[model samples]
Target: MTLVEAQIDRIVGPTHHFGGLGVGNIASQQHQGQTSNPRAAALQGLDKMRTVASLGVPQVILPPQIRPPIDLLHDLGFTGSLTEILPQVANDAPELLSAVMSSSAMWTANAATVTASVDSAHGTPTMTVANLSSSLHRAIEPQQTLCDLQRLFASFATIIAPLPGGAAMRDEGAANHMRLGSDLESPGIHIFVYGDQAPLPHRFWPRQTLAACQAVARQHGLPPENTFFLKQHPETIDAGAFHNDVVAASHHNLFLHHASAYYRADDTLAQIQRRFDDLHADGLRRIEIPESELSRTDAISTYLFNSQIVSSSTDQRPTLLCPMQVAENSCAASIVQRWIDEGLFADAKFLELRQSMSGGGGPACLRLRVPMKTRELSDLKTSCQWSASLDRALRQVIQEDYPESLDRDDLTNWQIAEKCLAAARRIQDLLAPTR
Candidate 1:
């Protein structure tokens, strides 16, 4: 099958702030209450998309989820009008106000779990927006996420209604999912890593349950043989690597992860290899970076694996799109240099996404890659795809609409909240096709 994989990244919203919302995300907590630059954050994200597009990759923007999320306020019984509700919630439950207003939706990697036609038993490309129902901050996302994607891929793809919201079916979206295909458009193994659900007094929060993974796979109709579910190492979670993506990442047929990423590194590799071999011998290209070479703390701190490996249409090796912090760290820089010398990657493109990095996200965290074939790609709402002009237009939106900065005190301001809502509507207007 001739297929194309497009990367969809969420544009940062004007209300972006250092709410430090996500549980167990070290950077989010460490950078809590810090002043945030909304303009720089969104522009940097756009710059990343532009870089990927220049490399011949099709790109799309998943516009930021509406901020000052009033949905939660209504649910919390602060009902009157948005103007009245804002002050009431701010006084009665300030923390809740902050949680709902978070810009965490910019990390669209956790937006959904996608299954390509090549990998699905039903033989149709599918998207199932995660019911990020565990943490209150993220729980409000699935509904709006579904609405935007439904509009974006309305004609071509099938989208599964989100799994019901609750702790039992806590789904962390694509961040906890990995696909390994020699060609992304072809069939490959689907690895779903969920945390230990039985019982544990672990220090950090454990997201992505096994039941949720199984439910998503079933919903997408993925063939049982090609799908693999593994228990995440509780130790890694305790160490502040909240999501699997923090320690592991894959591209094409290459799966590169830290040795401590899984519960039993060697055994997990063997099982994965066996599954791949069952399909075809030597189908897997694996690399496990040992702790001695790069420690787990450093891996999480620097986000080495969160880099996106973009393959060239030419014979050149894939370039690793990384956060500049990786190269700035002395030891990680040497290790990356060693990898380049060893022919592991073409080269590293370090991005100054300090805004995103401050919130525990990198290149990989910002996108959800969906592999589609010629027909499926064509069936997509073409207007939603990224273009040079769209980039300029979006920047114009920021200039005219988005806030320059967002701080803790701004959450309670009804006028600021109204402005945020107006700015979001303007973005929606920009996204709409010229009629």
Candidate 2:
């Protein structure tokens, strides 16, 4: 039973713009009201999937959700055709219009938290669609996201219903979760990082709740002994480390994070090391970037901790797929070189994700990883699989239909809305499951 981790990436939508909807993410706010190139943004995302596939790793595609969710507008007491509603909303309230036009779905890391069959009692992969109860723009995603997940994987995986309770049980999904094991085939230790266990001082409110993390563990049937819940440092969240992924990342046997990732970072690592050693004969590799070396401000700005650590075919250690910003940052570049010298990583691949990066996402944020058995992959639906043909087809659509550039004002244009809707539908059709 060979298990491999597959990168499930979502295609950037036609409405990709910088409305600055995210509350805690500093990058998103900093670039607010700027013009965005939807065509380039969507193409860059596809190119990333192509790059991941070229590395001899399995890659999967998740379709983007349709933008200008008019149903939401109708629910808000707007009555008319999409054209009529667009101008009405623009006149009545521009903020409400911006919320519906958000293209945040491209960052699929917040899509869901998945449990590999190796770690579950049922011996089948399980996914709990994130409720994303923190913000208005994101909160509207779960229903559509759940529908898409079910359509794609219902035959092979157990899709757990989103957690029921509201904001009190706010769930931000896999962005705040980490799993590490000796190998992909073995049972792993689950570390659910939450922002607040007890309310303390902070600049921004935490998105994930302790109750949500515990509920996900229970729903997935993860063994108690192998599961641990850790609290994110209050200061880190205030520093713009909105989710744990902003401060930490994990591969099969390696746990790489910043010193300020948790409230009690040293003790947390000790407990994780103990659990990892107990589960498998191999020990966990811990790499903690200290504040003296890289301040929390630098980590958030460069998105150094948001890189994806993936297994390499040519080397024993994994490769770091990081944003180009890290390579440009002198301090970040030096640390990455040090890691390579120490054999912590095989090498680093700098990806050009400026569009997504400016919107507060990086290489890791653009994906959702699912560890699947070869047998599971073999029997999986083919439409979601990545290949040269699918890549070409998606690129063509972006070139032909997606907007060259968009501003906040364009979000309220009915013609722009129509084009976006059509492009999303075309991509959705292209990735629809084949019988």
Candidate 3:
């Protein structure tokens, strides 16, 4: 009857290019149209998976989906064989081609919001894929993401479809959702953070609406008292921390966030405590890092809050799996050091994930966290499971096949398409031994 938690990280695909399409992600726009090293990128992701697994946590791999969505091209009225249409679209509409080629879905943090089996009505975990319909580039991801998740988790979880595409229904997924529990085995609290939608002082977009979060909670059949909703500080969004995770992170009973992470910060914590009190779950651990300690800009830029916190096997205290960039940034480095010195966590584990970082996603942005029982965990095969063999195989494919660098114009190259498909097929072969 033991329960466990799984953190699923998606491998960045061969089509990892900067379309600069993500409206709220500053790095995507900052590095737009720049040639990306896909080979190194995928390997870097593998390295991260290997590193996190070494840290005494269960890690799972979510495969990357085929990009330049060929089916979508056909739907767009481009009639031709696969080979012919790629060039036609590339020549006529490279911008559209760029959108199709985007691999931003690799950041599965936006993939969906998950409610664990312990929290759901049917005693099955429920996943809701984000529509991501807010932008032309991301709108196409949900359908494929749903298909893949169904194939991967069919035995043990209920999957919910994305909200209907509209300004009102825009759902950005787990980035807006944070789960808190005393341990992975217990019933946990679901905290949904949202931003203001109306045209504010600036044109900053609020990806998840309060309505969307509420609908998701009900879909999962979470009790009203167990679900809490809070408004994200608009000023943080304007400063480029678009999603709640940008400024806050929660695991087990610990809720670590910036002082500016939410409006009426102390009151939000009180409300969270009240909600947790209703559940009769373990008490909450609230860690608020004052802005005076670290500026919101530094927090967002260094992705300090986006760092993953796992229970250390050595001391059983929370340990941060932070991006290596945090150590490189003087402001962030000092704070992280001080945190460790003060025993906030037993220690910090820094990982190199620059490719994901280049696009404004960090360690926390690469995965979805779900708590489930041991039997339900067996529902997935070794392909999705993390291991040294799978790790080496994926890295080999990336080194031998994935392109070293790619830019916007390369989307039209049929040869690259064939190679990309081949690389994907190799990844497919690794997952071939499912069971």
Candidate 4:
């Protein structure tokens, strides 16, 4: 087992640990024109959540409005609470106000609603030339929201991959060129840039990513050799490939897959299949199921049979994490089903919320896990009260009377309730409060 996998086994006892997770509001007007269906986005979010839940960790939900969305999360069996923590309000001290008045009365004049003009000359006048209406800018920027969401879930020691520079700095190309320095201080934090092409023509992200990793190593008081850079095979930038890179790198193992040639759709599957075939041929009998199978039965069966045959030949067992798709399935939901079908993933209580976004990928693809010192399993059990409360809340929501059209097996109250109970129990155990 890789060091991270081992440590996680120790800390949460075979339960996986994911670090970044949040709920994205696809119901907003901004995404209406971009996606074919808003419900797909929501379904994707729920699916990712289910994936996280299946790992046996509390999937943290960060939404602007926490309560209403908690119902959907409950349906996915998330035991974590839906809570909002507003950013620290900027202080407007008298000295700061005096400075602002001296610099630009325009700002002071705009505050007239709060206070009458102090003096005609002393009072600031709003600058018509530079004044930007708040109404025009009220929409939340994805990057800023991501940073704030990271802060809110600091306890998870999460890191956020900022939106690609092109995505963040629409017009300022140079801004995107700025890479993270090699000496950052947050060990738990990592940034996963989305696009394949760097915002700037000459700049490469791998170099900057390496530097950031070094910084994280320094912060953790580890040697630079301890840090490694793992990138996706260009063609298979899908969730499974991303996670495999993370797991391999976390154990100080080099990713043998080449990104340039292995990412093609036809080539991607062939490459992955070949890798598994090679492993079997080499007498390495264990194989973990890729997360891509939740939606693809044929692929799952093929892999399972192949791995089982290989195991039988080698007298070693092959394990599958249960195939799950990051595109439309909830990690928790799929994982639960996997657990129900095969008992491969043990201790479903230590999984952490890794990454969640409106259009990118699931939690597993958003963050990377590093090997760390492990803790005893007994230290991880959570409280039963919270689980009970979550179950009650889910029951209340799903059992409510609604339009007939809204009712379906996927939306059944019983299914939601059962998942909620399982999630609550798992979460309470994972995040058990200290005495």
lDDT (CA) per prediction: 0.82, 0.88, 0.81, 0.24
RMSD of each: 1.9, 1.3, 1.9, 18.9
State the lDDT of candidate 2 residue by residue for 320-412, as single tens digits.
Answer: 988999999898999999989988888899999999999999999999988888888776677889989989998999999999999988988
Q: What is candidate 2's TM-score against the reference?
A: 0.97
* Range of the 10 consecutive residues with the lowest summed lDDT in candidate 2: 196-205
Q: Can you give the TM-score per candidate against the true fold? A: 0.95, 0.97, 0.95, 0.32
By TM-score, the best candidate is 2
10 residues in a row with least lDDT, candidate 3: 195-204
Summarize candidate 3's per-residue lDDT along 97-199 as a digit string, tens digits. 8888888888888888898888899689899998886788778888988987787787789988898747787888999998887655677888998786443
Best by lDDT: 2
Query: Please, what are the lDDT tens digits per residue for candidate 1 over residues 228-272?
Result: 886777888888788888899887767888888887546667888
lDDT of 4 by residue, 328-400 (tens): 3364255444643663333222221111122222222221112212221122223311233543443333233
Can you tell me which runs of candidate 3 are displaced by over 4 Å? 197-201, 277-282, 312-315
Per-residue error at 401 for model 4, in Å? 13
Of candidates 4 and 2, the better by TM-score: 2
